[model samples]
Target: MANLLIIDTATESCSVALKYDDQVYTRSEIAPRMHGELVLPMVEAVLAEAGIKLTQLDAIAYGQGPGAFTGIRICISVVQGLAFGADLPVIGISSLQALAQGLYQDKKQARVLAAIDARMGEVYWGQYEVDANGLMKLLDQERVCSPEFVTISDPDTSIVYSAVGTGWSTYAKVLSETLNVPTVIHDKPLYPFAEYMIPMAEYLYISGESYAAELAVPVYLRDDVAKKAKDL
Candidate 1:
């Protein structure tokens, strides 16, 4: 197993997690507008708690986002600097998918509708299903759209689906009615947590998907044109 460092500042919260010796260490705070100051400290604290240097880790995983623009920038800058200093590989995980993976771990459910409140009357949305391997896989295109514009194509009524994140909280009735199912409201994973990125990074690492420090990037699903994941 690869020792990994994870960083997420793609929203109001700032968090860091370190996976070493098959154990995970994490720290986070709901510190909006403080990502620039809090992210590095959280990273330092996790590394100290794990009693390891940055260079000892196998890779650095980051929350590549469709979130607060400044928050995403902070995370990417930190990850690139750390990866460059440690000469380690870099991997990016989607903020929306992170919420689903976190829900899968916390709720132990297979179906998830993860959304984030994208300002200017829109939301960053994605649906995820846990396969037999217990990994959350995106079911369709992730996109930036108004709540009314979101749709689920031929969803299975046989399975119970759960909704999470600020977007759901903001427009619960709209999403619940749109998905057309009995939905559970969860608030624990309103922000993407770095710890949840470990499984994904490990998966990508084994699949030989690592990148250079300069190549570490964010997934800003939003653009002048309303774009879909498949369109990217």
Candidate 2:
């Protein structure tokens, strides 16, 4: 088992989590424009509470987005710097998957869709299906586009599932009027949480899905979006 550190400032939430074996220690705050001010302190708080040091961490995991351009960049840079300083492996988890994982408890089914409001009338969307072992696998590459045009292109739609994300909560009327799929909207679980990323981080760590500091990158779905993930 690895001692892991995870961070996310990719939305209205600022969160940090440290995981060892099966235990997790987390610190989070809901501050829209306060990512810069809150992230480092949050990380220190979580590490202190967990009795872990950055040097002792086996790896650092971060939410590489399909979320806010600025928020995504801040998280990547923080993780990159911390990992580099500690000489630890680094993993980038999908922000959308973290949001979907937050909805596991309310599961009407195993399949899930994660979306975040990408502003400019568009959303960052992705699909996933949980396996028998309870691990989630990505069903498709993530996308960013207007909510009016997003759809389930996959033909197999047997199970009823809940939709989790701020994008859906924000564009409820537009989505309802557009997509015909039956969904139980989860407004409370909309924001992506660092705690939700732990299990996936552990899996990736075990599988050696990690990289060096210079390899750290954010998955920005919008090409024309000026700001890179580091700007947050």
Candidate 3:
């Protein structure tokens, strides 16, 4: 049984969860700009509900960046502090990947184009393909670009894919024109949820992707020096 704690405040959603054995306990809210206030309490609530202590966690996992700057930092800072005090390891899962995982169902293989509304009329995007065995692999690295930027650079666009994340929803017309494929979209699944963060964190833990608390870092597409408030 792996005891894993997960959090995602990289988007408007503030969510936390604990995974023990085959059971999951989660707390989530779609309150934008409330990540700092809500994440820690949600974490505490989930931990308490599961009867697990911080030190018992095998790893602390977080949805690391490519979303709200302040929101991402809030989650990473908390995870770092908790993991450091507890002497636990950490895994940094991409917010985009977490969004992709949320689209998974038992019915069929999942092909997802996960992106976040990066504001400034641009987006942070990636492609993911999940196999029948329930393993998701990134088909593309995370990138930031305009919604007009299509992902399919090749001609073999044959997979039945789902367009997910707020980026797609917000810029649907631009994305649809860009991708040219008739996309099956779930507008609500764009944000990362705590529930999707656990299994991936567990897998990374088993695979030794875990790092010391201080080593965990969020990924921001725009360098601080390059970003202007006008972009936000």
- Measured by TM-score, the strongest candidate is 1
Q: Which of 1 and 3 is ahead in lDDT? A: 1
Alpha-carbon runs more than 4 Å astray in model 3? 106-109, 153-157, 224-232
Q: In model 3, where is the ten-residue run with the lowest total lDDT?
A: 223-232
TM-score of each: 0.94, 0.92, 0.91
How many clashes (backbone N, Cα, C below 3 Å) per candidate? 0, 3, 1
Per-residue alpha-carbon lDDT of candidate 1 for residues 1-232, written as tens digits (9 for 90 to 100): 8889999999888899999999899999998998898988888998899898999999999999978877887898999999999999999999988899999988797788899999788899998989887889998789989898887646778767888899998988887876787778898788888988888888888888989989876778776532543354
Cα deviation at 98, candidate 1, in Å, is 0.7
Error of 1 at 14 (Å): 0.4
Query: In terms of TM-score, how similar is model 2 to the real structure?
Result: 0.92
Better of 2 and 3 by TM-score: 2
Which tens-of-lDDT digit does each residue in 187-226 have in candidate 3? 6665888788676787788888898888877788876613
In candidate 2, list every pair of residues with a backbone clash.
70-232, 73-229, 73-230
